[model samples]
Target: MRLQGKLAIVTAAASGMGRAGVERFVREGAQVAAIDIDPAALKALAAEFEGVHTIAADLATEQGALDSIDQGVAALGGADILWAHAGMPGPASVEDLDMTAYRKAIDLNITSAALGAGRVAPHMRKRGGGSIIFTSSISGLVGSMMSPIYSAAKFGVVGLGKSLALALAADGIRVNVVCPGLADTPMKLGFTGRSGDPAEAAANEAKVVGAVPMGRLVKPGEVADAALWLASDEASFVTGVALPVDGGFTAR
Candidate 1:
């Protein structure tokens, strides 16, 4: 119950790590406003979580980001925790990448984070304090051959978190990023494009596991747990850290 009585906002919360965070936060007694672009999934989530507030909005624009936060505030009185976790994978290589795809990646992964932080920091400052968590990735810290645009965008998120941490500390707001390794999610499945071949995809995915010293892919819930800790009073003294929930992948 580390987050008991807290008000949290989780972006891209229809599925994957974002969904997991929303679920965990609610279970820990937090009032959560879950934002997602997928209307159907958002509806399902709202139905599942009796007290949860779900906002179906596209966060790639400044207005969208502002509206989402405004809705969250309206629902929960104020936001105690902000999980800016919306993102999408771009092209696999520089050669194959298009400008449109690159821009989309930046919009979803970096710009959205910047806007979300900007919106939440003010409310948190007014309240005297708050926690902000960005969903970064191993790709942010290291090179990823799988998606160059995604890596670049994630790197921007890490940078945004660090800069915001320093700037907002005086306002009693803490900002940090969590870098998750390969995890099983719809996003990952979409990245691999191997929906029809489980065996082949599993073998290809094993390559990532082999690279990790822990010899496994991190679970979505596991990353959610780390996010919960960062958003709680347990991490009161922590800020500006790019924590790797990567199962030793980054260590190697």
Candidate 2:
């Protein structure tokens, strides 16, 4: 109930951390706008949440990001929190990287966050204050040899949070970033490949687990909880923080 009666907009909300965030916010008493690019997923989300507003839009563009926020504001009357969580991971290694794909990944992962916040800032300002939370990764703090592009993009997100925090503080708007370690999600499964040989899959899983000090992956709900805290009044004095929801991975 920390977010009772608040209005929120969560992008990439059809799956993974975004989907979990929408569910968590709703349970915390916030009216939420769940957005994603998948029409079928958005439809399912709308059906699943009676009062939630579901939006299907390509967040790779500034207009799409702005339009979705506009619709969300109109649906819920206004927005008190904006969680710009739309992103994609890039090549695991530079040798496997394609420039075109890398550009798209950076655009989707970094540019969308910047534009999404830019479009929503005015509306939050009109209300006198609001919170903006961007999604980052533990790779953001360090560098990922496996996915250098993803690491770079997430690093940009962390930078965005800090810069926006200082820029918007005068207007009572707080900007923060959540850096989650490896999480068990459909996307991760895709990246790891479920249909691979059993031995290969086991090895892959072991490799992932071995990287984290906790010996387990972060859960989507855990990331959502961190995001929920940042969006709620409990974090009123918290801003410009890159909170690590990682299981001590960054510690080592």
List, residue by residue over 1-252, the lDDT tens digit for candidate 2. Answer: 899989899999999999999999999999999889999998888888879999888887777877888898899898889999988877666785688888878888889899888888888999999999999998799987667889999999999999999999999999999998878987775345446576765677678789888889899999999999999999999999999998888887
Task: Identify the candidate with maximal lDDT.
Answer: 1
42: Cα error in model 1, Å: 1.1
Best by TM-score: 1
**lDDT value for model 1:** 0.89
lDDT of 2 at 153: 94
- Give the Cα RMSD of candidate 2: 1.8
lDDT of 1 by residue, 55-132 (tens): 988888778888998999899999889999999887667885688878878898999888888888888888889999
Off by over 4 Å in 1: 194-200
List, in order, the clash count of every candidate structure: 0, 1
